[model samples]
Target chain A: MAIKDLPRDEYLLKGHAACPGCPITVALRIALKALGNKTILVIPACCSSVIQALYPKSGFNVPILNIAFEAAAAGASGVSAALKKLDKTDITPVVWAGDGGSYDIGIQALSGALERGTNFIYICYNNQMYSNTGIQRSGATPYGAWTTTTWTGKKEHQKELGEIVRAHHIPYVATATISYPEDLYAKVLKAKNMKGPRYIEIFAPCPPGWRFDMSKTIEMARLAVETGAWILYEEIDGQFAFTSYSKKILEGRDRKPIEEWLQLQGRFRHLTEDDMKKINSHLDEKWNQYKKS
Target chain B: MKTAISLPTLGAMGKTGTWRVFRPIIDVEKCIKCWRCWIFCPDGVISRDDYPTIDLEYCKGCGICAHECPVDAIKMEREKK
Candidate 1:
């Protein structure tokens, strides 16, 4: 869909506490536009939890249940069950979590929920680290990206949270970014229509955490997709297909050099030539895995 | 605007304008009225009327509206003392 075709209904109201140019806010806005008012958001200890603001004053137009740090998925599952009991199945229960909550802390609960075929949408707005908690490194933090815990750069590669969730043989799993709102919106709509566990891990960039100019959030997100650092694809009932942008990359379209993406962020400013090459190869490996899948 | 214990009423109740370091000023003559700034504003402070109107009461002056304006219709000016 064209950018102009996106719905203008503001489910995520303005005056939110999110940082200027915050991608998580953007993601939530776009996703909620697609989900509509009949949705209950279950957010854990993440930026959204704080961004949603202190209780008695919320940034969200929809009902949001703030849960424990490691209980987003579990909390969502309970909400979903309650909806079932109340015969309010039309109301979509969504787990909006951060990478810190989903990839590391809440994985066990998420895995169990997915295994039980919980009917809900689990969206991990991955800023690559524990951004809300002061940029501490999380499992989703990419290689060669500096964080408070990883002063030099995170040595290990980002964990494949999508693949791990897909392993549960859920109804749907997808990867997206705020840059591609049409695709993200479409995926959320599709997930909302289907029953069973659905997961979409969005590559949301944190300006303060990633040390990038706040205004460059969209540019940075677009560059990540164009460089193939973050692949956009959906897996449905074990069938994998690359979405719009990633499909082009998979179809022999040359991606922009990884440096174009890396240089835009301060986190990678400390990297040497060899370090960039290492990251490039790591990206290549990841792309190859997606191509094979 | 009834107050209930449910959810905080929408609109700029906090008067977040106090948080502004830079305030956005729109040039009506230059504005195409594309609503990009209105749509992209995180605070939803920009009104989609005949001309874009910023409700400064809630506008935190993030400069997003100015930054996203394609026609350069909006400019971020430093907040006065």
Candidate 2:
């Protein structure tokens, strides 16, 4: 469906506390449009909590339960159970969190909820660092990227949270990015209709954390996919298939050099040629796996 | 005991227009009205009719609309201090 075909309802209201050109807000706007009014958000301690603004003045039209940093999935599970008890199956319990909340602190709770077959949507809008807490490196922070804690660069590669969740063999799991709104919307809408645990990780490029021009957020995200730095795919039950531009990349559409993506972000300015080689080899290995899959 | 809860309201943190260094000006004559600007806007400030109308009161001058526009229909002009 086309962009105009999407619902015109505005669940994410205007003039929130989000910074100018925040990718999280952009992704949320599209996801909320798909989710519609019968949705309750379970937000943890992330920029989204701040983006929702202070008490007595919310930026979102939907009800949101702001929980602790590590309790997003657990809180969502409780909300899902309560909704089930009330026979309010129409309402969706969505956990909107960041990398710090998902790949790091909340993984245990998330694993528990998924294992229990909790009916909820867990979305990790991974900006690759603890952006809300001043750009510290997190488990999802990519190798050779600078953060407050990683002054030189992060020594380890990012945690494969999607693969970890996929191990649960949940009903729905997808990787999306802010650049492709339609793909993101479609995935969220599909996950909304299905039962059991759903996980979608959106590659959100932070303007401040990634150190790019605020307006270039979409460009940065697009470059990520174009460079094979990020792959977009969906796994339903046991089946898997690449989607959108990533589908093209899998079918021999040449990937642009990762440097095209890296040079744009200030966080990667310190990455040496040796580091670049490591990053390229890692990407090759990932694409090789994708090809084999 | 006090509780923290927010009611849905526009401009939750006061006017964001002042935060803008640049303001987007749509060239109505050149407009294609594709709705890219309307969808990509983080604040949900742009409304679509035949053409798009931006709500400058809450628009943070992100320039995303200008950057994402397929055509050069939108321009980012410096906001007057």
Candidate 3:
């Protein structure tokens, strides 16, 4: 269904503080369409929080609950349970925040919510760093990436937040992006229908944070999926299924080197040919093991 | 086969979290001015004249139009699907 006809409902409107071409903005629009106007949005201190001004003076179309930076998940869970107790189970609770909030400070809250299978959706809009805090490095920052904390160049150490989320064995967990509206919208609709906590990590490119052309936000997201950098998959009941990640890049089994993908972004510009080989080999090995195990 | 890549560019963030492909298609009929595909295209491959045109020449097929199309005009046809 076209996003427009999806509904005339307004959950998130324009004229916000998000950077130009911010994928998160698009993601919010699509997500809202799927969620309809029946959701209560939970946000933390991230770019999204900035998208709307302080409470009572915001630009979104639904009610906003701005919680602590590390309590998005926990807070959302509370709302979900509270809604059930009040017999308002029709309302869907969404914990929407940035990577830093989810993978770092909020990890504990997220874990707690997942364990109990909170009846809400936990969405991590991963822009890859603590973008709101002056580009500080977060656990989600990629290898060889250069964030404020990893100024010298991040060593080969980046955590797989999606894999970790799936490990919870939640009923629904998927990686989506603003670039693919249908897939993203469809996933949101699917998650909305399912009960319990659902985790969807979306790649929301930040222009000022990532050091790329403002116009290439969606391009950047596409590159992430095209290359083996991002693997779109989901885990249900322990058996995982890939959604968009091509097996071609799987294990570097039958694909080209990773250099083609890295060269497009300035963050990896400092790496030498040898560094690329190391990165490629590492990714290749990881993919192989990921598929095997 | 030429395109512009201006330097000093502050590229956006990539999930690098997965590998996926999303391609865009045009309905030609359902597509009305709107200019969404032309205005929001990250690659600038969409035509600017009257209607939206996909320059397969340089299109990486990210399916932004399909995602952003106000009407259900654009659709994502997975290369493999």
Candidate 4:
């Protein structure tokens, strides 16, 4: 169904503390529409904790458990177990974390929950850096991107956390972005209906962290998929297939040069032609594996 | 206030509209009523009925609505001093 057909109820309320054109809020708003009121969000120390606004008042209409930086999945597991005990099978427990929380700090907790087959949804909105801590490089930060921690550009390639999640053989795993709201909506809705550890990673481009114009947030997200920098797909049980524009790209659609996506962000400004070659070659290798599959 | 549960309420962090440098103005004549602006608005300030009406009290003036609008129906204009 089209975006207009989605529920019109507002779960994320007005007058929050999110920066102008914040990517996290854009993604969360769409996801909450799919999640509805029966959702309890388990948020770790991330931008969302701040976006929920100060104590005693929150922008989010749903109940949120603000946990430590490395306790999102652990907290959600507990919530899931408690809900099951309470016979509230309809209430969904969701872990909404950032790259720093999911890929770096909270990975162990996430893995444990998955291996235990906890019935919950874990979504990592990967901005690729610790944006809440003023843009430090994280495990999800791409190669040749500048962060406060990586002054000359990050030499290591980003960690494939999605692949790691898929290895758990969960009932559902997906990748989405805010640019394609319907794709994201459908994926989250599908995950909500499932009864096992379901994981979703959304490629969220931070406007301030990526050093792009605030208005260009959605454009940056669109270019990411069009350039093949981010591939959207969902894995159900053992079956895997691409989704949305990524499926078209896999079927011989032309991929825009990664430079088109890289050049707009100031984080990639330090890259030389040589650096571009390295990045493109790395991306090619990744795509080649996909092409072979 | 001492309670651990923080029930969400409107304007929790106070009015954020004062942070705007450029406010988006919708051209109703050019508007297609696609709800793109309403869906993309981060703060949930834009409410949709027949046409969308932005609540300036918390509109962050991010210009995302203007940028995402297909018909160029939304324009980002400098806020009055």
Q: What is each candidate's DockQ, to 2 decimals?
A: 0.39, 0.84, 0.04, 0.82
Q: Give the winner by lDDT: 1 or 4.
A: 4
lDDT of 3 by residue, A1-293 (tens): 55334443435433344554567766787788789888899999998777664433565667778889999998998899899999998899999899999998999999999999889999898988888878888898877877778876787567878878877889988888765666788888889998988999988777777787655677677667776676676665566777654544554545545666667667777877666777787787877787786
Categorize the docking of model 3: incorrect
Show model 1 residue runs off by greater than 4 Å: B1-6, B11-13, B28-35
TM-score of 4: 0.98
Q: Itemize residue pairs with steric clashes in candidate 1.
A: A14-B43, A15-B43
Name the 10 consecutive residues with the lowest summed lDDT in model 4 chain B.
B1-10
Query: What's the distance in Å from true for residue B39, model 2?
Result: 1.0
Tens digits of per-residue lDDT for model 2 on B1-81? 977778999889899888999999999999877788888898889998878999999999989999999988999999776
| Cα-based TM-score, every candidate | 0.92, 0.98, 0.77, 0.98
Q: Which 10-residue window of candidate 4 chain A scores lowest in summed lDDT?
A: A1-10
True contacts kept of each: 0.30, 0.81, 0.01, 0.79
After superposing candidate 4, which stretches have Cα over 4 Å from the reference? B1-3
Model 1, span A117-158: residue lDDT tens: 999999999999998889999999888999999998888988
Candidate 1 chain A minimal-lDDT segment of 10 residues: A12-21
